[model samples]
Target: MLNLFKKKEKFILPVSGDCIPMEKVNDPVFSQKMMGDGFAIIPSDKTIYSPFSGEVSVLFPTKHAIGIKSDAGVEVLIHVGIDTVSLKGEGFESFVQQGDKIAQGDKLIDVDFDLIKQKGFDPVVVIIFTNNSIKIEEKLHHGEHHEKLSISIK
Candidate 1:
C-alpha cells in the first residue's frame, strides 16, 4: 500500500538537441542498453546540465563521463561523445566534482563538440541508467524546454 507514496521525479534534457532511440545510436554498448536503459541526445549546445537533483557519484578523470546518483537510488551516467576517453580530458571542462550535490539544471560540464568531431568522435550525449532495476515511467519529448523526460523510482 505504501507504493503510492514513492517519489516521482522528472528528468530534464541535459542538452538542447535531438532525442533519438537508444537503438539508433552508433555505438553498440549504448545501442544494446548494456550499461542500462536510458536515452541519448545530440546536443546543439556545449553545456551539459544536470538532469535531476543528485549527488555526483563518479566523475571520470578524463572528464568524458559522469555518474549521478539520485536520492531515490537511481544512477544515471552522462557520457559525452562516443570514444571520447581517448581524448584524455581534452575539449572537456567539468563544472562539478565527484560527490558534489547537484540540482536540476546545474551546469555539469562544457564540451567542445567541434574538437571532439575533429578528433574523429561522434558527440552524442548519452544518458544511461546504470542501475537496471529503475523503471523509466515515461519519456515525454516536449519540444525545446526544461521538461523532456520523467522517471519514477519505486
Candidate 2:
C-alpha cells in the first residue's frame, strides 16, 4: 500500500544541452527558484523541444519563451536566454502553435545562438515547474542530458 502512494516518474530534457543548477543561473528570479524547482540548460543544440507531453500554454511573441501545461497537470515554463526579450524575435523560430498537443521531445522552437551572442544575450534555457507544491523525485543534475530525466510528482 505504501508503494501505491509513492511519487515516481521521470521528465526528460526538452533539448540537448548542458544542465546547470538553478543556483548557477545569473538571474535572481530563476537562480532563487522563484518560478519553481528545476534546473537550466545551456544549450548544445539550437532546437527547443517539449519537455513534457502537454498543450502549449504560452508562446511569447518574441519567441524567447514558452509555457506548457502537461496532460498530467504540471506547468512548465521554458524561458530562452537571459534578458533576451529585448532581442525582439531576432533569433528564434516557433514550430508549434498555442494549444497544440505536444509529446515529449517534440520540436517547439529553433534558436540562433550565433545571432544571440552577437547581440549580447545568453541563451541559457530555464525550465521551471510553475506549481508551488511540486516535489521532485531526483534532486541532482550534473550537466548531462539523459535519454530521460527521472522525476516524480507528489
Candidate 3:
C-alpha cells in the first residue's frame, strides 16, 4: 500500500542514437500535435537496439512496440511509429521475445523504413519510460541525427 509514496526515479537512454519527439501520445491520429511527455527518437535504417540492460517486459504481437526493464529497476517502452501498431507486423520484425534479457546496444527489432513509409506511416521512433515517477538529470540534446548523444542518471 505504501508503493504510492515511493520516490520517482529517472532513467537514462539505453542506446546512443537520434532522439525523435512524437507530436502526441496515445492518439491514433497521425496529426502532428504537441507532445505531452518527452520521448527519445531514434532514427536509423538498421536494427533497433536495447537502450538499457533489462529483461523484456512486453513485445507487441504487431512488432510495433516493446517494453523493457532496466537493471536499475526502470521500465521503458519503445514504439516504432504512429498508428503503426495496426499494421500487425507487416514491415516490422522483432529479434527478441518477451522475457528475453537485453543489454545496451543489443538488437531488439528491425524496421523497414521503406515498407513503413509505403504503409503510409512515418517511421518516427520513440523511447519512453513506462514509469514516470523518476526525475531525469543531465538530459542533453546532441542534435538531430547526431551519433554522440548520451543519457545519464540524474
Q: Clash totals for all models, in order?
A: 0, 2, 8
Candidate 3: C-alpha RMSD after superposition: 6.3
Between candidates 1 and 2, the one scoring higher on lDDT is 1
Task: Give per-residue CA lDDT, model 1, range 38-67, as digits (tens).
Answer: 777778899998877889999999999999
Cand. 2 TM to true fold: 0.85
Kindly report which residue stretches of model 2 are placed more than 4 angstroms away from their true locations once superposed: 1-10, 135-147
For candidate 2, lDDT tens digit of each residue in 43-98? 88999888667799999899999999877677889999999999898899999888
> Which candidate number has the best lDDT?
1
Global lDDT for candidate 1?
0.80
Q: After superposition, how far is residue 47 of candidate 3 from its true place, in Å?
A: 1.1
Evaluated against the true structure, the overall lDDT of model 3 is 0.62
Alpha-carbon deviation at 133 in model 2, angstroms: 3.6
TM-score of every prediction relative to native:
0.85, 0.85, 0.71
Question: CA lDDT, every prediction?
Answer: 0.80, 0.78, 0.62
Stretches > 4 Å off in candidate 1: 1-6, 133-147, 150-154
Query: What root-mean-square deviation over C-alphas does model 1 reach?
Result: 4.2
